[model samples]
Target: MATKSLASCIFCKIIKGEIPSFKLIETETSYSFLDIGPVAKGHALVIPKYHAAKLHDLPDEYFADTLSVAKKIAIAQGLENYNILQNNGRIAHQEVDHVHFHVIPKPAASDEEGLVVGWPAKKPEMSELKALHEELLEKLG
Candidate 1:
């Protein structure tokens, strides 16, 4: 079945050639292009041709293809270290509704321009952790 495109989505427009982009890679089911607002020098965005607002909404094949293209781009850029970031919803800082993956190349661990993640580790009750794990497992099934 052919997936419907989102007329108002910028990524959809780019895929349709309605908008111009500095394309990096074009695959059978995905498209990669340079990010206009890049955090690093070789920052790129890979997105599926199908219009999916959330990552889970994408077909399995589309999701796989998107990641494959992202990996290819990373290799081509000679990126030994990089970050693959996917934001699902607004709360996760996903400004764009279309599902896309960010491939950001990092030169060093101290590179301020690259992804800086902070982990505030807390000791949670075993019951809480087990409950969350069970919920996720149920959803996965």
Candidate 2:
């Protein structure tokens, strides 16, 4: 793979041992760490050792490995419920550029600091919905 932008990227520094994170697991393809700013207790972020700013940019191997790490953490963390969130781009509210999956452990009663999932309005105009569906289909196929 080609060299990636890692100069000042936080995750890169974490991978390079330049920073410290609450590391849960590490493997050849991916690294898993507890989120310092977690959505909930045991909330973790899993990412590839290689840099990628968005989900589509991520290598399949790395994505798979990251998910594997997340699953293990979920079970080990004793999560009653969980959500896997991977956002991209500014519009998606992805604060970090690195492609990371948030493994959030949500229970019946969540702490005030934890993530509370929200579903935005799905009431788009028919034309807008159709156009978006077509575009996504093209990309998928």
Query: lDDT score of model 2?
Result: 0.83
- Candidate 2 lDDT, 16-89, residue by residue in tens: 77899888899887888989987677889997888889988876767677888889999998887788888999
lDDT of 1 by residue, 1-141 (tens): 376689999999998889999998887788899999998998999999989999888888897788889999999999999999999898888999999999998888895887887778999999999999999999999
Q: Pick the candidate with the highest lDDT.
A: 1
Compared with the true structure, all predictions reach lDDT values of 0.90, 0.83
Residue 63, model 2: Cα distance from true site in angstroms: 1.7
Highest TM-score, which number? Answer: 1
Task: Give TM per candidate.
Answer: 0.91, 0.82
After superposition, candidate 2 runs with Cα above 4 Å error: 1-5, 109-113, 123-139
Q: Give the TM-score of candidate 1.
A: 0.91
